[model samples]
Target: MPEDARKRARRRLSIARGHLDSIVRMLDDPEVYCVDVLRQIKAVQGALSGAGDVVLRGHLEAHVATSAGRGDSVELVEEVMEALRYR
Candidate 1:
């Protein structure tokens, strides 16, 4: 992966980690609002999605764009399709 993309993905994951910690703490508090917990959960999901996007973009730029000349276009397409199956 490119250095910049790796750094950005790591930063988003760090934010997600912090939000996950907050969610755990909130779970321990009997008075915490359910909506607030859901919001934190959403934040974590968005961070994870952002990380996935960065990695996919990097892959497309660094590999997929060159697969035709590399003679691996078929395999690369399948791999990318599997990776994006959830999305």
Candidate 2:
């Protein structure tokens, strides 16, 4: 991956990790409302999704297209599709 894309993705993942840590803390707090906790969980999900998008974009731009000339592009594309489908 390009340095910029990798840095951006890492930042996103770090945000998600912090959000997840908050969720765990909320779970342990007796005063936390269910709706508020759920909202935080959704936020974390969105952050993670954003990170995934960054990684996918980087893979397509930096690897898949470059692999086309080497004859492994189709396999890589299929792998990406399968991963998306399962996710």
Candidate 3:
């Protein structure tokens, strides 16, 4: 929720959007190589992974830590465990 975190998230999303656009362009252009497409796919995956890390860090630092500080650690742990089960 901090301005810096929001900016970083936005930047990552923008990179993802650019990757999508590149894929579309590649599809339209017959000369695009198969390896190039694979590279773009990897880039998109890495960007998404980076974004997930950012979000997880924020959640741990803000929500989880705060909940634990407030003596609601058990609830927070249960919620995380339930989420993992669903995953």
Best by lDDT: 1
In order, the Cα lDDT scores of the candidates are: 0.93, 0.87, 0.78
Give model 2's TM-score versus the native structure. 0.84
Which has the better lDDT: candidate 1, or candidate 2? 1
Per residue, candidate 3 scores C-alpha lDDT tens digits across 1-87 of 456676787789789889978988998989999999989989988887777667656666777878956999989888767655633
| Candidate 2 regions with alpha-carbon error over 4 angstroms | none
In candidate 1, the residue pairs with backbone N, CA or C atoms under 3 Å apart (3 or more residues apart, or in different chains) clash, namely none
Looking at candidate 3, the ten consecutive residues that score lowest on lDDT are 78-87
Poorest 10 consecutive residues by lDDT, candidate 2: 78-87
The regions of model 3 sitting more than 4 angstroms off are 82-87
- Model 3's alpha-carbon lDDT is 0.78
lDDT of 1 at 61: 84
